[model samples]
Target: ADGYDSGGSDEREFADAWLMRAHGHNAVDLDEIDAAEDALQETQFLLDDFAGLIDDFESQGGSARDLFEIVRQVVNNKKTEAGETN
Candidate 1:
């Protein structure tokens, strides 16, 4: 909220400058927004195993990145087990 606009009119001048730099003199593009949203959703799906990994790590202490690596390994195994990558 400090560096970016959250629709507050009190910072109109700063927000306008930020917008000009962000959008490069072009109108805001909905297609770009949609594509970014779609990419985020896709990444969210891949992290479906994150919750389980956190629980597992809590029970057996290890680095957080280790848990993420374990989740990535499990997901990779599952994908390869089915002979597909999704």
Candidate 2:
């Protein structure tokens, strides 16, 4: 019954998930990993800035920040494991 019904959540989720996978696959490649991390950081910043505006988005759209947080945590976990193995 709101803007989310327009497929915003699905689309954003899809994009974030796809990019997260791409980053994970290339995590060992410093350049790709750094670029992906930077993009994730930017996404988080935007979500934080518009936290209030989300309410205006109808059905209360979810924050991309949450999605980004998951990706970051996952990446860091892998990084930690790599460090431990080294």
Candidate 3:
């Protein structure tokens, strides 16, 4: 969902792997491909925000980890909404 930053191949592979672990993951289980695509786009927005936080000289104002935590929350919330998490 990270905005399909990895694109379709990467996204498909991720969904396939996750489905395998979930045992018989299907279209719904993985979510509509379009939804995943949309989520990826949203994440790109967050990434841009994170990148902007970098100091003008490329120094870190803070660890990118904070942004990553937010990203994790976004994706986790979606998964929970779909009832697709442990």
How far is 2's C-alpha from truth in model 1 (Å)?
43
Residue lDDT tens for model 2, 1-86: 66554467888888878898888675567798899999999999998877656555434666657756877888889989888532
> What's the C-alpha lDDT at position 10 in model 1?
61
Model 1: residues with Cα > 4 Å off, grouped in runs = 1-24, 50-86
lDDT tens digits, residues 3-84, model 3?
Answer: 5466568888988888878876443544677788989999999888866765432464555567678879999999999999
Q: Given candidate 3, what's the lDDT at residue 17?
A: 89
Off by over 4 Å in 3: 1-62
Alpha carbon lDDT of each predicted model: 0.81, 0.75, 0.74
Over the full model, what C-alpha lDDT does candidate 3 score relative to the true structure? 0.74
Better of 1 and 3 by lDDT: 1
Q: Where is model 3 poorest over a 10-residue stretch in terms of lDDT?
A: 54-63
Clashing pairs in 3: 3-40
